[model samples]
Target: SQFTLYADTSSRRPGFSKAAKPDLAVPLYEKFMARCRERGFQVEHGEFGADMQVDSRNDGPVTILFDTEGNL
Candidate 1:
């Protein structure tokens, strides 16, 4: 069985700041489901979105973790 994952750092909605924009939900959902099919796993999908508005902003790199079978 094989699986594929897709991620995007940009959003579908426009006019919002990159840091505050909602992500491309449709593409993300499609890719996730497709990967489940390729892996022969029963499709279980979850998504979370946020627009964090923090005072006194600090610049830093963003990191995401996709846990597959308990492996980082």
Candidate 2:
């Protein structure tokens, strides 16, 4: 069995100049979801341009971060 998580985030919005950051990400996000579905991934996502909130808990007091800027 395999499991993975995905999130699409952005910080831009056009046309509706009064919009906020991360507003123009819906189209890109939808494409991602479609591709994942085609690849047989368990799909779970909110509607495009919808406000969302997420929470998480860790098992221990240690956390690690990865910077993939130039790893390729």
Candidate 3:
């Protein structure tokens, strides 16, 4: 999965100012990926700010979208 943290509000051009800073986000991303690794899934990822390209295939036609207001 490609986790691109984004801002809450919409705009023609996105500015991820509301996204978690790397100090916070990186550790969480690492922990999540580690859990996936523990589940026996081979995983590979790029550095925090690297440009990445993903080529993937979906076996099932399921789509879900979520939005958050930053209120727990």
Put down candidate 1 lDDT per residue, 1-72, tens digits, no spaces: 121233432444222233322357556666767988899988754434433444554467874544444443
Off by over 4 Å in 2: 1-24, 59-72
- TM-score for each prediction? 0.29, 0.42, 0.61
For model 2, state the Cα shift of residue 34 in Å: 0.3
- For model 2, residues 1-72, the per-residue Cα lDDT tens digits are 011123222222113444434544556666778899999999886555555565667889896443344342
Query: Sorted on lDDT, highest at the top, how do the candidates line up?
Result: 3, 2, 1
Q: What is the TM-score of candidate 1?
A: 0.29
* lDDT of each residue in 1-72, candidate 3, tens digit only: 365757553434556787888899889989989999999999898787677787867778885344344333
**Cα lDDT over the full model 2:** 0.51
Pairs of residues at least 3 apart in sequence or in different chains that clash in candidate 1: none
Q: What order do you get sorting by TM-score, best first?
A: 3, 2, 1
Error of 1 at 58 (Å): 36
Evaluation by TM-score, superior candidate among 1 and 3: 3
